[model samples]
Target: MEKVQVSPSRTGSHDQSHNAKWGIAAGFSASLVGIGLARFAYTPLLPAIIDAGWFDASKAAYLGAANLAGYLLGALTGRVMAQRSSTAFTLRAMMLLASVAFFACAFPVSYLWFFVWRLLSGISGGALMVLAAPAVLAYVPPSKRGLSGGIIFMGVGVGIAASGTLVPLLLQQGLKQTWLGLGIISLVFTAIAWKGWPKQDAAPVHAVQHPRQSNNTTLKALYAEYALNAAGWVPHMIFLVAFIAHGLGQGLEVGAQYWVLFGIGATLGPLLAGVLADRVGFGLALRLSFILEGVCVCIPALGLGTPWLMASSVVVGAFVTGTVPLVLGRVQELLVHHPAQQNAAWRTATVGFALFQAVAAYGFSYLFSYSGGNYALLFLLGTGAIALALLIDIVASRSVDEAAPR
Candidate 1:
């Protein structure tokens, strides 16, 4: 089906000067497979992988880090790849790679095999993040960028929700089937989105004649804040269910239920953030998201009952998942003149976030070891990182008005 822009025509019909809606859907499906299924789905699958006797706990953790390491490499590599290839090609290729990776995981292979597939999946996902959004938003009017981008970003949350909701049921069947199921889902979405991308005939979607010096201070600050978000968001995505079920004396079933709520919040977040960004500026929307996420990060520590814990789950889910598109909107606006830099900047932000989260995931173990199971300290550390991100955004806002043109 052809996606139409929301504008009316001068001839008493719709005027789609651009296929704005299709672009958004293309970006959305790319993101859904990339971050949503490729990255976030790992957390939900961890237990199943362990139960399937693929790796010990230590090796499993290491394998998880391998995925992040690949994400870092992919982010850097994707920037260069985007300059050389069409978004339609790269997007379709990555989807195929991701589908292959998930299909490979279904086998009871050696640890190295699993590692390689996981790494490939991460690379595919990271590249899409770098390439897909800009392709979709390139033709969208500035006024619609936020909501359109948000819709695309909502794919991540949708993927998350699918993993949280579907994985558990898949686990009941077996790990092999779960892996196959995920691969099929990726393929289905990829097929649906394949035609949504517009063909590029003039220049590559991310072409650059020369490397130019970047002068956008707000862009840099946004990148830094984007990095910091990894500290707060990843832990909850990976560990919130554990802390809720075990740390708070709830059972694994209870934790699983809460995770679904988190996924639900994530699923809805991008749309909400998109609307919010449209109403308020991207900067304000981003700042508020970070602030609210900080509060949510600390919410688990108050020993709140199920009600409060559930609320925290939703808010944390929404904010953590929501911030990506919101930040991407700002990145787009800043580099609107230099479309090539938009891909580079997005890749740079992902690299920072990927590397930080990879290191933080490992580092949190030491904090966990030293505290003798005081998971609260780990949560505190996460809160501190978010607080610092919030501070940076606030300080940057005061010193440099984001309203200035690059």
Candidate 2:
């Protein structure tokens, strides 16, 4: 037999390709554990926690707001943590923290204990959301980045779907056991993703080389739009399950089933939105998403029946997650030549989203208590916010076009 030699370039390409696949897997796991399990699992669990007498409705709602508050902090600090330590180290640590938070939540030792753990879970989720995709995408070939990014973010939808399906079954085992089950699942994901991160983190941005100045007007509008979108989605994110379970007099199981539908929509949202953006342009896709989401979000407020509610769950779920890629794509379009500026714009958008989400959570929680659990009011308000965002985009797009050299 003749010996065959492989060239260095070919071998290096093979290794890079191998590592990129694992990196995408790690990114997916990070999102599944961080955002899916840490943040969304709590939505289904909210009504259960209240029903179990672990906390009164108002208190439990406020506890949900605590996670949003922590998310804001984590979004602001995630990059700093990566810079100080390393992206991989920070991602793994955050996943472990989220898993630990789930276990700690199982006890419900006190309101303070549960609040602290939930907040920690939110922190983990926010950090993972910030760091995971960029770390993985840095290694992926440019041609595949779009699809890879969609696959990674689909973890959130998967996590949401899992909560809708698995949480109900786990609840039957007992609430304590449900928490344990979630923790076990998160831990397994953590272990699986441990070695999947890229051997090298994405190269740090050097601001000195890449000046951050670019279309300021467009960037400001984007930040505002992203923040408003975050605010508008809070009702469904934190209260949909409770509203159905308690507000509509539907049982927990029925509410969980609706959540499953939402999860299914969420799982498909990003991919669908990406394809739409490719066809119609991100700006148009974004505006259309706003219109669809606003209508869906208002269905419950209109006192609609099961079919409408089902449509609401699925459409709102899809738009809620779908809007993400649209917004990111828009940012890329706005700052096409300025990579550093694009990153800065995205960080600003993310921070604005976290800030508005935290504010809306607390504001809505207070409103919910004040209105005597008026779920419809919250839905209307959410719809109003989305409408405002659409209005802003309409105005901003026109202005950007007029300012362009024809």
Clashing pairs in model 1? 28-152
Model 2: lDDT to the true structure: 0.90
Report clashes for each candidate as comma-separated counts: 1, 0
Q: Summarize candidate 2's per-residue lDDT along 105-206 as a digit string, tens digits.
A: 999899999999989998988888888888888888878988898899888899999999999999999999999999999999999899999767767444
lDDT for predicted candidate 1 compared with the true structure:
0.77
What TM-score should be assigned to candidate 1?
0.85
Q: Total backbone clashes of model 2?
A: 0
| Residue pairs clashing, model 2 | none
> What local lDDT score does residue 101 receive in model 1, on the 0 to 100 scale?
89
Q: Each candidate: what lDDT?
A: 0.77, 0.90
- Tens-place lDDT digits, model 1, residues 269-321: 98888889879988889889888888888878777677887888899889867
Q: TM-score for every candidate vs. truth?
A: 0.85, 0.97
Q: Top lDDT: which candidate number?
A: 2
